[model samples]
Target: MADDASFPAGSEILLLEDDLPLRKRLAAHLRLHGAEVTEALRLEEARRLLRDLRFDFAVVDLHLPDGEVLDLLREGAFSENTGVVVMTAFGGVKQAVEAMRLGAGDYLTKPFEPDQLGVAFSRCRWNRRATRRDEHRSAEPGAGAEELFFGQSLAAVRTQLDTIIAAERRLERRLPPVLIEGETGTGKSALARWLHQNGPRADRPFVSVNCAALPDTLAESELFGHERGAFTDAKRARIGLFEAADGGTLFLDEIASLSPGTQAKVLTAIEEGTIRRLGGTREVQVDARVVTASNRPLDDLVAQGSFREDLYHRLNLLRVVLAPLRDRGTDILPLAHHLLARIAARHRLRGLTITRDGEARLLAQTWRGNVRELAHEIERAVIFSPGPELDFATLGGAPIPSAGNWRNPAWRLPESGFSLETAVNEFIADALRETGNNVSAAARRLGVTREFLRYRLSGAKEPSAPPDANHPGG
Candidate 1:
């Protein structure tokens, strides 16, 4: 009887419908069920109420006189606690999919039951409440603080951040698990933490596990815990990361490396919210939000049979792809500055500023290591810079020409002043001539990947002017 719950007591609901009679009946039903109801007849009125109050629930009619209600989901007008239930008389499966993708918690057709309205909010609140309770029972204590952050950069990077922020605003019932894909050192783990901190369960614990770092022999026990004497080394009963993170978030970084056995077990926990400790008899239920990050393509891995398709489906509900630093356009210098300041503060050194030349060098180069590499460079620069200003040398390595110069030969500049990529390509071509087109000797002489050189030679983009402070991006 208790499991067949109706709604959370005193839950604040925003009900928007053009049909006044139907809206009133829905409001009356919700009010009678002990929910605080706010009614709006027009989209504009709903927009106004959303701006002023934080509601626990939102029941929106899809077609309004002004426009479709999908805009509200796109704009994130409602708070994160609001589980948007889109009701429509005209729309079908396509509309429902669109609503779900845009962050609706539930979708309903016209002539649906008031009790079915109750059903829409059930899984989310129940899981959320259960998670909260689990947090109280966690054996390991949680840190009471959370870090807050917002990121900005040039156009490409800016677009990426905007997409991430939009996804963060969605208040789905179960808080759809996120799959973050990016190159190594591109801040995949950092982005995962940001999502957890900004989400509805922010106040709860955030547990991070580096799947790649865990050894195959012990990863299962480490993740799912082990009862005393469950394995050769099990001396006492233990709690797994999932239980520790109940009611909060579990960030699995480098998740693509998880072995098949571990992957299967993790999928079970995600799908059923339950896990059995290694050597334990009973299954323990957990309610931790899952966020996974991978440096490689999980799809390719799945196709290769290295990963489970079912697990990938469960984890890839919402996606955030972090761009490599080199592709981020004009955001390079601003990020460098931010990193420099933080690095200086952390090291107890005087704040350091990047010189103009330093900025140019920073903007240039293939940052194969991405943001993490950049941070290390900044830290190194801080350690050696005598004055408050940092030069290119302090950042380490000679200033390399950007990919732009190689990709485009028409961009005008002094003879040798701006010919890094062009010069490198020319030298390689000349080497081929000098060696009579011997690719093996060319590769050996150049000490570079033959594939790498070939890619550059064939895949160069249209030439563009050097990056200017006025125009920045990857």
Candidate 2:
């Protein structure tokens, strides 16, 4: 398995291609990039390789002699973490869409260059690797669901929540689909869980799905049941999440990440109160209340055509927006103490308190990760504390940007307003300088993708800042 933070290096790869020339070229390219390549010319050979060797990733040509390469995906031939990418000479929208629905991590058209292959490989390489176990461990029902501590800023939202509760009481059979929008780590999941525990369906089932972490393949069938023979490897008719959460609530977190196909199915299910198993024709009515949460704006996504407008409207029927921790001014210290008490109790400590310096640090710091980050920091402090008091000195710190250029520290405004593009260029240059001209390290600091950084660099005017071994990630 690959590390939590690096690319797929020294990982075993299974390459299946009927075109011998293409297969040989791709295998060599992968090996050159630090992969152990296992080549296969036919479906049978690929099956034998899959059976015999453990692989980190599989590159398969959709048009295999024995059958569709999708069969290998369906047959449970690859481990859960072993990502797969599909390639085809006869590429079309239908094929690509089908590949996505079938759970391939990425897709590529034929006659592509080694660079294109690497792009596809990269997609499957750094894909989010959180499993259901990690989900359960991270989202443990922290504190009680009944207790909600909100500052004065949340008065309006509190009223909205009360309205939801009232509506839930009146609507005996079904509830309106609720949507919660907030930044990451702003307690969206916790709020969703709270609603499930407090609502009329308190005794019923509650299913939570992290949309960002869902595998690309089998997403639709997983949400809306699937029949036995829905595809190659679905041996038994399985109840989808909707069915599993029947007469209860289904919470979908980071809902913006859902694909267009999955989004359509979800919209249909919500509007019609019916779900058809992937291969089955019969429509089964489900009484599950969908409460989706997104860290991004769904309206923007809808306008951009990435998200369906109908789905967005449906989800917005009952919407709640959560304020980020930074904006929740008075709640900072109290929230810190609340978390500290829980951590101390769990660790069997007599008493724990945050010192004055710790409180100031919490208030002054820009919590990029929000409440989730605070919780983790508090836990670390409790575990490693030599004594009871938690001091800010023990926690590490980073450089703070000046006030005038908080977002862009090194850039300054001249007497004449500078162009926005020029400002961005200078910011990139400053980042490179700070990191000593290392683009990857600078990208990490900038919180942008390497591709984004490189695009910025490439777009710069004449005298292009050439980046190679000397300026990495540039």
Candidate 3:
């Protein structure tokens, strides 16, 4: 298995190529780079090796003597942890996409340089880790469905994050650790992901874990790693989060839960750029950017002696805070609408909306769970809504009666201005459709006279007042 980060050095690799001279040269190159290479000249020989031994990575040609490599890919011949890089002379966009979709980590058009092979293997490693991360996220409940939404109220926080990303790009190596503090369910994990996706290593892996979820006995082994026979039930050696996230970001949510002993090791890893696996003699180097989040303020934890003061100071250098949802008064409605849209689309529902009363009910809540609570409320409303309007009957209050007034005092114009004319037209059109194009009914629904509605529908200039107060259906 490959313990070293980035390249394939100090790992086992399988080199599969049909051409004799090319195979020998490639094997020698990989071996020179400190990798243990096993060479196979045919598909049958490769299959035999694969069945008999476990390899960390495989560099295989597309067309083998006995069969095509796609056969093996479709059959899932490679282990889940084995990173595979395919080389082909007849490579195209479609072929590459197909190969990756099947199971291959990376695709390469052949007649390439030896250096490119190393780079491809590096990409393969990242791709494999990323795929595993995505699969794990998908398997968890309510994961990947919560999109990051930073509305007008979060504008300053967004600006600060952008500044941090800019600073990160300018530095060549060793990105500084970032600390995110917020209440539970305030989207701290989402924010960490946003930072990683927008930073210099967007193409690299982003590994995430909840420190609070790790049991006390396994915390150190999970974060650092464990060698075979390190403890009871230690079946095999494994790479930890730091090594898996090499050259990218590692997000630790609820980091305050780590024990003092584990915290010291984390600090050492961050400061010294190395970690020693449990029951292992040599220290392995890792360069994963650590981004940690805490539900409670670390300052309080440090004061109580629950957290290490030195580690707190180190992470406090680059910090961003997320305000609770209740404090973001103006952001409630827009955020609810965004959540509504996503929930509706996922259930194959359309034209879903929040009534004025529903909007009022949403704004009145304390939102103790922040964005997470809001999302659940929206999903519940979608499930119970009898029509297009979400009245939020689950909110436990009688619906507020409409006063036939369209102008809402609570509605504030967004920082980015909108097209008033287009908005008005869309509202009128929607009313007309609901009323079966009955002009009088649409006018009544809009709290306007029939004459005014017809005038606007004709695309005429705004009338100073009603043309005829006594007009029919006025």
TM-scores for all candidates: the values are 0.53, 0.54, 0.64
Selected candidate, larger lDDT, 2 vs 3: 3
The lDDT, on a scale of 0 to 1, for candidate 3 is 0.80
Q: Which of the numbered candidates is closest to the native, going by highest lDDT?
A: 3
TM-score computed on alpha carbons, candidate 1: 0.53
Prediction-by-prediction clash tally: 7, 1, 0
Per residue, candidate 1 scores C-alpha lDDT tens digits across 412-440 of 33322444877778878976886797765
Local accuracy of candidate 2 as per-residue lDDT tens digits, 240-267:
7776566677888888888988898898
Candidate 1, position 107, lDDT: 80
Give the clashing residue pairs of candidate 1, or none.
131-247, 328-474, 329-473, 329-474, 330-472, 330-473, 408-463
Return the clash pairs for model 2, or none: 103-217
Q: After superposition, how far is residue 317 of candidate 1 from its true place, in Å?
A: 1.9
Kindly provide the TM-score of model 3 when superposed on the true structure, using C-alpha atoms. 0.64
Question: Where does candidate 3 clash, by residue pair?
Answer: none
Ranked by TM-score, top first = 3, 2, 1
State the displacement of the C-alpha of residue 294, model 1, in Å, after optimal TM-score superposition. Answer: 0.6
As for model 3, its CA RMSD to the true structure in angstroms is: 11.1
Model 2 error, position 428 (Å): 45
